[model samples]
Target: MWWFLICLAALIGGYFIYGSFIERIFGINEKRATPAYTQQDGVDYVPLPTSKVYLVQLLNIAGVGPIFGPIMGALYGPAALLWIVIGSIFAGAVHDYFSGMLSIRNNGASVPSITGKYLGNSPRHFMNVFAIILLVLVGVVFVSAPAGMLTNLINEQTSLHLGTGAMVVIIFAYYILATIVPVDKIIGRLYPVFGALLIFMSVGLMTAISFSGEHTIMPGFQFGDMFSNLNPHDMPLWPALFITIACGAISGFHATQSPLMARCMENEKNGRFVFYGAMIGEGIIALIWCTISLSFFDSVDGLADAVSHGGPGNVVYTSSFGLLGVFGGILAFLGVVILPITSGDTAFRSSRLILAEYFNLEQKTLKSRLMMAMPLFVIGGILTQVDFGIIWRYFGFANQSTAVIMLWTASAYLIRHQKLHWITSIPALFMTTVCISFILSSQTLGFGLPMQISTILGFIGSVAVLAYVIKVAGKHKNLSHSDKATDNLTRIT
Candidate 1:
């Protein structure tokens, strides 16, 4: 109990102190015109109020992630506490803030654009493909997850019967509508309502846990007992836990999503609240789910059994239902179903913008938006029929892999300007190791290699990446000087 309380306190305190330090490091300017103002196109680049942008960003990055991801992460026991708190403060929030600020610096460019400017053309092209695939996967997963939940709700609570296939069509229709319309038309208007539900459910769950009696509900998880793997499968904690908990900790997907809000932000200073602060808000939500999942079950084994039997949805449904009864059922619907739908829409929206930017097409008109969006939805709709677990596992891997690229890109940006680069550099190196090891050792992707060999490969990969980044930075510096010398000689001549 003390450990949980302390972790919660630290996260809240870190947001004000550590978050402000990051803000200073980024050197945000109040007077400079943002892309939303200078490049307002009445479509994707329209300016939004600070409050609206903050809410939309929060809900956009969140989706069903904080709920489902943390529930699964809790399979490792209280170690999740450490990851959510530390990762959110040092890694997740920092990743999000820098990514958003970088987008603003680049005329509201997508992640691939920013990556191209800093990491060069080849990596940018790779990232373009990687981000588009990840977004489409997100769209598929969100659609399937919510529709399945809605089907379950109807079957469980109502006499009116609806199959998942029907729900899929209905949800996909709404997704297409949201994706093709103007940002202000669908996402900007509805996200606030969904955001309010998220806040209400998180706070309500926290309150329920607080009052449910310490001995029974709050089982007093300790920091010292956190290291012993509570997972029934004895899953390695290094990469699996990190990948399982991407959203509440550090996610690459946030970088793709940030550019959308970046296009709407009114000022550079608001980056902290919209980008960094929204991540902290997500961390809080993930923490609540983590705590509730652990405390609600009789033991770690019981939680694991529930998850194995029914999936993370079981945790959401059982915990919320037990704690708040009928009201908890409603909260589960909002948290699990409504939230992901919101994120799915934005995922497709970001995909549309990325495609528009890639092909150099105007998005100011409906015809152009529909032309880019129809193919994405067709693929996403096809994907909803594939196995959900496989899609989710790949999404998690791609999510962290993208984070490494974005982090390195940010590091290169800082290095080129001669600012402190270690902040992004250290995390980039760490996540790079995690992603590489997960690939080499994961049963789904890799050969399920031994942990020792995986660790060794991770070490080599991290070193190689760091060497490449340093070499590139040096070349960029030299190129800048060479261009400067040429300009000087030409002026003098």
Candidate 2:
């Protein structure tokens, strides 16, 4: 009951406090100027209402990462939830909000572009390459786990043997609709219904689980026991926790999603609401998943077996909805279907943006869009054969590494703009320090001295990149001053 109340408080606080920030930061109000380059159309570039934008951001950001991050965090005990909540608001939400705002200010340019503006060309390119590699790793590992869970849910409910084939069909259908149908027509109208259904089903499942009187799964380790679980073979708690939180803290995908959302913002002020607000909602979703995992499963082995065998062979969802019996099963199935669609759509849109930016493809054509998405579809299909659990850990690490780069960029932006609020920089700095420390620790303790040496080299490389960013910032400031002086002289003449 306390947990429920906590969650409700987080949601209400997020909507009101963070929602107001959105209006202040990105709203269409007169305080912030809209980018002149934003080409507003009734379709792709159309400005959405704040509520609609919030829903899209929520759906786009609420992927498997949130679900799995909390589950991993729960390994450290319920105390981890405290970090998840605080970090979501401070570190995660701030990073996401700024990334979107930067993209919008630069005409929907990607993080790589923003990095180049503040950092040098070489560092920008390096970060972009790193981000793509991380994203691909993420796609390979993280994309299929939810699909597996969804398949299991369908199979258990209908006694139908849904497999990767079913997953493929569903993903393909979403892509087709996203590509063929107009964004304005489909997103505001149909997508909200899907979003509402997902929320309803998730809530219903939680309620059913609570009332069913099933054995509640608790964290295996106490707070003190977390470090003791560190083993040479099994990934240690510190590193694992670091990676998991890093994904939540900062992600390259946030960069992609921000720009996509920026295209739909009615004004710059909406950034706070859409970008930060959505992140808070995503954090809440992660919290719920973690809570469910902790409350439902008895042991680590049981949870592993469930993940390995397609999410407890769907019995978990079915049993979760036990309150409504058959009706609950139906709701569970609908939720299962909706989860993948939300993620798949976001992936499709993001991949399109990346391709359009990198290859300079014409986004208006059907062939161009299909070509952009083909690689992801092909790779996703192949990855279905591999073990996702092990891969997911690596993805978490790589995703965090990407986030580190974004934090670097965002922190630089904050400094350059002289908006160096401690609320923003402190969280960014803390997450950056955590990520770098974990990488160093992973190399030293986990991978030995030689790996540690490589990690040090990576750290050096990051420092060099930071130096380059500082140099560019200095140059940009000088240029701004020079331009202002020239304008004054012209006025005097």
Candidate 3:
């Protein structure tokens, strides 16, 4: 319990100390005019108060990933807790900080566009396809997850037998409206309310856990215990846990989502609050879910059995219902229906912006916005029919893969200016190895290769990528005017 409290404090302190350090390294310039004003489309590039943008950014990236991802990761035991704390402080927050700040630096460019500018055209094109597919997967997964929870909630409460398909349609309708409308219309208005629910849900669940008479499966924390692989399914701890317990840790999905809030930010100084602070908030949420999942189930095996039986959604619903009672049921609705819906809308919204950038179409017109959003909905509509569990697995791989790209991109940005590139460079290399090993391990996201061979290959791949990143950074390129405007970039508030 003491260790858990310490980890919680670490996450909060990371925001004040580490977040500020990253902000300084990036050289935030409050003097530069942001896209919200310079290119205020009132649609996508509309400016908002920093507090409002923080809430919007929190909901946009929070979704259900912080909940479901960590819940699934709890099957691996307390290691998930450590990952949520450590990864968020060192990697996740850094990834998100750069994702938004770099976009702000580049006229609110999307992830692919910024990556292309720093890493060259190959990655830009790869990220174009990669980010789009990941966003669609996130959209489809969020759509189906909430729809499933809603389906169960409705069936249990009323005699209504609404299927997941019906709920998906309702969600899709909302997504289309959220995607095509101006930034202030649907998302901006409701995000603060939704973000509040997300935090309250976690805190409510934590209070329930603390007062429960049930025997918790949680073991006393030891320094070495966090790294032990306790997964019942024999999954490797190195890459699989890192990949499974995403979003709360370090997610590439956040990178794509960051640019959405980037365009809405009123100043560069707000980047730390809206981007890095939101990730730390998610880490807290993920930690709560992971802790309660372990406590409520009584054993890691029991949690795994529950997961194997009905998936993460079932685990979330059961724990919420058992611990919090009738009110728990209501929060379950919010967890399944509201949280994911908030993220789903922004997922599609970001996709619309990215597709517009792909086609070089100005998003100033309603017609152009619709043109970009239509295809994402069609693809999401088709994919929602394909099980949420499978979609989530694929999304995790793509999510982390995208994070690696964003990390490397940030490293390139820092290295190009010769301003302490190691902060991002180290994480980029570590995640690059994780991604490499994950895709080749033949276990979860990889091919049918032996673990030893997969690990060796991952090492080789990381080295090659490291060499390439250094070479790219070494090119005699000029930092953008925004990167040089304020060298101190110091503001505590």
Candidate 4:
């Protein structure tokens, strides 16, 4: 419990101390006009209040990843604590801050566009396709996750016999409506309510933990035993821990979502609060979930047994009821349900904006918005037929892979301006290693190589990539050269 409180403090402090420092490095300007004013598209680029943008961004990135991932990561025992705290402060918040602010600087450009601006056209084109695919994957995953849960909840809690198929159709319809509408119409209006549900759920559980003999219920962080791997399955801790705990610590998906709020931000000064502050909020949620999960089942082994029976979904259900009772648990269930649905809506919405930015298509017109949106839903609908496990396996690796690119892209932008580059560069190199090592070491994703060989070669590949990133950064060291290159590109509507 003490460990949990300390981590909570760190996440808050990270926003004021580290987040503000990153803002200064990026050089936020109050005088400059944002795309919400400059672009002035009624659908995607409409201006929103800072408080609303913060809540929208929070709901956008706070998908099931924060809750489910941390619960799963908690299976590794106390080892997950360090990654959630340190990674959120240094790596995750920094990555999110730049991904949004860079887009704001470039007139609300998508992740692929911003990456292309700094990295190169090759990465730009690759990311253009890659980001759309990743967003589609998110849409499919979030749809299925919540729909299935709703099916069960409705059937058991009410007289309604809702099937997963029916629930999926309902969610899919809501997603399509949310995707094509104006920025403030569906998403901006509803997300604050959803955000409140999320926080209320977390607070209820926290209050329950406090009254339930917390020290005996939750283990304190220990220096000696903390860093040790406690996975019941004895999985390798390095890449697995980092990958399992994405979004809570750091997620590439946040980069995709950041631009959505970036277009709505009225001022550059709000970037840290909306982007970095949201990431910290997510970390706090992750920390709470991780602590509650570890303690609720009496032991890590017991938690593993529950997970084995029903996966992380089971962990969420059983733990909520055990800790919060029947009435509170039902409300908690609604909060959990909202997690994926909110993300699913924005996942498709971000894809529409990304395709619009990439193709230079205007989103203000109904036809133009539908042209980008319909095909994404079609692709996502087709993928609903694919196995969930296969999609999930790729989502984890791809999520981090995108993070590596965004970090290096931000690093290059810093180098061009001759500002502090290592803030992003170091994390970029580290995540590059994590992504490479994770893929090579996993049997389904890679060659099923042994850990010994994978670790050694992953480092080698990451170092080689780092050297190339440096070379590219060096080419843009003259701010005039980089500025000229940016000025030449077409701005996205």
TM-score of each: 0.95, 0.80, 0.95, 0.96
Candidate 4, 1-493: lDDT as tens digits: 6777887898899889988899988888776778788877788889998988998899899888998889889988877877999999999999999999999888899999999988899999989888887899999999988887778767767898866888889999999999898989988888888898899999888778778863355655366657788888988888888988998999999999999988999988788898999999999899988988878876788889999987787788777777787788889988988998999889999999888877888777889889999999998999988887788778888888888889989998898788999999889888988888888889878888888888888889888987888888788787765586544534333
| Per-residue error (Å), model 1, residue 446 | 1.3
What value of lDDT does candidate 3 attain over all alpha carbons? 0.84
Name the lDDT value of residue 239 in candidate 4. Answer: 87
Task: State, as a TM-score between 0 and 1, how close model 2 is to the true structure.
Answer: 0.80
State the C-alpha lDDT per candidate: 0.85, 0.60, 0.84, 0.86
Which consecutive 10 residues in model 4 have the weakest lDDT in total?
484-493
Clashing pairs in 1: none
The segments of candidate 3 whose C-alpha lies over 4 angstroms from its true place after superposition are 215-224, 443-445, 477-493
Selected candidate, larger TM-score, 3 vs 4: 4
lDDT tens digits, residue span 68-128, model 2: 5666665555545666677677677877887888776666677777777666687678766
In TM-score terms, candidate 1 sits at: 0.95
Candidate 4 residue-wise lDDT at 22: 93
lDDT by residue (304-340, candidate 1, tens digit) is 9889977998677777777787868677555668888
Residue 15 in candidate 4 has what lDDT?
A: 88
**Maximum-lDDT candidate:** 4
lDDT of 4 at 139: 95
CA deviation > 4 Å runs, candidate 1 = 214-220, 478-493
Which scores better on lDDT, 1 or 4?
4
Candidate 4 colliding pairs: none
